[model samples]
Target: MASITGSSISSSFKLNQALNRVCCLKTPSISFKGISLSSSRLNQATRRLSITCAAKPETVNKVCDIVKKQLALSADTAVCGESKFAALGADSLDTVEIVMGLEEEFGISVEEDSAQNIATVQDAADLIEDLISKNA
Candidate 1:
């Protein structure tokens, strides 16, 4: 999508089609056939704007473990970074316990205000990393 402002019409058309596929089909696959990227400032700006900061795999795994344990989920249950606490049958007290477990495991303290903002495993992982880095 960063090359959306490319110099080729075919590229733009393909990007538009890919965007439609993502929006309509709810798929992560995007095809960039015949896309010619131009070395333009606008394209560079678009690239910067689209950049995302994802959680580290180890951090996500640890968070997943804590979340699964707190929720008492079985080994067969699939818990990923995207798994939300509420969706995993965790209430407010359960979320607090999960946060406590994360804090103890990571040796990082999470603020009450910050704890309230965590919903998904990725959120908890990101916060743990942030807190650990800040403390270090």
Candidate 2:
């Protein structure tokens, strides 16, 4: 009877530990999704991620720089050219990298199908702006 009691107590303690561990794991995830970071903090992070917005004239140039570096493309040609990524000779693998790079830089995930529709640099910037506002 004493051995049985000891086993029961040990099992209860293990169960409690398991529950506590689950709670600890879930707590931060719940808080992170529920809490929205302040704009100043977000903007600072965005700046660190290489997001830059200049006046209209420099806008395209900056966007091109971001796309070129992020996509590992030639700096000589403009990214604003009227060419879809698929039309620009990018394969499925290259397109995935491009999308991932954009998401990392913008702090948002561009849906796979929607990414296929992006034709110009402004399209990407617009989507990032929308996603940032929504996430905020």
Candidate 3:
């Protein structure tokens, strides 16, 4: 039993190495764990990686827009910089959706701790600005 287990582990390692080499070759696409990664997808990812630093006011306005849209608020709804999401009638799920909207809009991923710390629209704007700068 022990010999069989050891042989299986060694075979698995060799298979993984072979897969890595094949995936590393200049191919238009590669499949791993049932997910296909294409060159076009890689290009899109590279495009998304090109972050631009926007002015503070612009970031705030964009963040507000994302929040308003995520919450399905009226276009005329006032989203003040200091307004807390809770004040805007956002529940936990709403907050998560808002965070997702922000991520999609900015093309940047927010850490769990950082996302949890966002309470106000201004907080979200500030975090987004910071992320943009770091990504830039």
Candidate 4:
């Protein structure tokens, strides 16, 4: 009977440790029966969790660079977030090649529908961020 109780305590401790690792971002306490476990310790093990992948500044810059390189645009030309590929003289073939370049650079496959929707530099950056987060 004593050994069984000891084993149960050990298992509970292990379970609490695992929970702490998963829920370390939030300071939430979980209660099991009458025992409470707090995951607010600064020294506890934690895993990073990214819920959303929004377009970051660096992603926008990289996308702009890719677009400029793919289209062979002049260095004097500016590619802003709202700058549409079509406005930048990108034809259907150019657009396809640009999408392929993005895929190769980011190591993520872009769906046909999603590829068609990428009009502006911001759109490509946002899609790339989402794909990267999903892959992560």
Most accurate candidate by TM-score: 1
Q: Candidate 1 — which residues are off by over 4 angstroms?
A: 1-53
* Stretches > 4 Å off in candidate 2: 1-63, 81-83
TM-score of 3: 0.58
Full-model lDDT, candidate 1: 0.70
Cα lDDT tens digits, model 1, 1-136, are: 3334455786666565444323212224332444443335434543443344366778888888888888898986667655667767899999999999998898988999999999878789889888988899
Please name the candidate that would achieve the greatest lDDT relative to the true structure.
4
lDDT of 4 by residue, 1-136 (tens): 0011236677576544444333323454555554655555422432222223357868878888999999999886767555678767899899999999999998999999999999878789899999999999
| All candidates: TM-score | 0.62, 0.45, 0.58, 0.60
Rank the models by lDDT, top first.
Answer: 4, 1, 3, 2
Per-residue lDDT value at 96 in model 1: 95
Candidate 3: which stretches are off by over 4 Å? 1-55
Worst 10 residues of 1 by lDDT: 20-29
Write one digit per residue (lDDT tens) for candidate 3, span 1-136. 0011236567565444343233213333544444566667744543443233233767878888888888998876667555678867799899999999999988999998999999978789888988989999
> Backbone collision count in every prediction?
0, 0, 0, 0
Q: How close is candidate 2 to the true structure, as a TM-score?
A: 0.45
